[model samples]
Target: MDLLEEYRRATMFFESGDPGGAARLLEPIVAAEPENASVRQLLARAYFASAQLVRAEEQLRALLEIDPSDHYAHHVLGRTLERQGRPEEALGSLRIAAAMRPDNDDYRAALRRVEARTGGRPR
Candidate 1:
């Protein structure tokens, strides 16, 4: 299949709660298009949903390196870190995401949750 077709199928699989399938479809795409932020983000999300926290973290961190101002990358990285039991690391990313996009409820909520876990202190 073409890259676009594979991407569409992967997105369908992810939306249908079959993140493993999405990850399978997305892996090659990511390898082939490492600079494609959208594809990388989707792959990271797929990895995260499938409980592959390490892969998700790697992808998210790479995405952040490509675009440090990417709020979504920060948000996902924060969630991935939190899932990996690294609340202190997660708090920084979550706070950056929330501060970058104050109107994003999801980012704010994540920041709040992480803050609560870290003694409700703004670090």
Candidate 2:
């Protein structure tokens, strides 16, 4: 299979609002290129957008293992946990993302919302 063309197809699917389709297309690409951060990140996002929180969390966590400095992975992991109703578990990742990208309003907002939810003091 032409992975690059497939990746483009997946990207188009994601952009067209068919996250599940994008995810299906991306799964094989990710399996073939486990270390491809861009592919993994997009797959993670597709899972998240499709409400597959567990899968999203797994992919996001793997992304972090590949690059712990990935603020977006941290943020999305926090979001996945939050969506799973595990606000307490979400706090650590949210905090890390917020700290890593202090200029990111979305990341800071996610942190604040989770902190408010869990009654945790801001970090």
Candidate 3:
């Protein structure tokens, strides 16, 4: 099957609340396509959903290193940071995502929430 098909299967599993299955499905794809930002991002999402916060953070960090302009990576990184009780760091990452896609309400809302928690502007 094509990569897209595999990715879709993983996404379906993730959306169905089966993150472990999704991660299992995506892990090899992620390893094979280390530079595929979308796969990395999806794998990170699966990791997060599975409560593997550290792994999610690591994947998102790698994604950002590969493409600084990847708003999704910034957003996910912010989420992971927030979950880790680091609101300041979350704000910094969320702000990058928000700046990259100013029209996205989810990104804007996340940025605002992080800013409020950190008692500072979205960094």
Per-candidate TM-score against the hidden true structure:
0.94, 0.97, 0.88
Q: Per-residue alpha-carbon lDDT of model 2 for 25-114, expressed as tens digits?
A: 999999999999999999999999999999999999999999999999999999999999999999999999999999999999999999
Give stretches of model 1 more than 4 Å off: 120-123
lDDT ranking of the models: 2, 1, 3
lDDT score of residue 83 within candidate 1: 97
lDDT of 1 by residue, 40-108 (tens): 999999999999999999999999999999999999999999999999889889989999999999999
| TM-score (C-alpha) between model 3 and the true structure | 0.88
Worst 10 residues of 2 by lDDT: 114-123
lDDT of 1: 0.93
lDDT digits (tens) for residues 43-72 of candidate 3: 999999888999999999999899988898
CA deviation > 4 Å runs, candidate 2 = 121-123
Spell out the clash pairs found in candidate 3.
none
**Cα lDDT listed for each candidate:** 0.93, 0.96, 0.88
Prediction 2 TM-score vs. true: 0.97
Q: What is the C-alpha local distance difference test score of candidate 3? A: 0.88
Best by lDDT: 2
Counting clashing residue pairs in each candidate, in order, gives 0, 0, 0
lDDT winner between candidates 1 and 3: 1
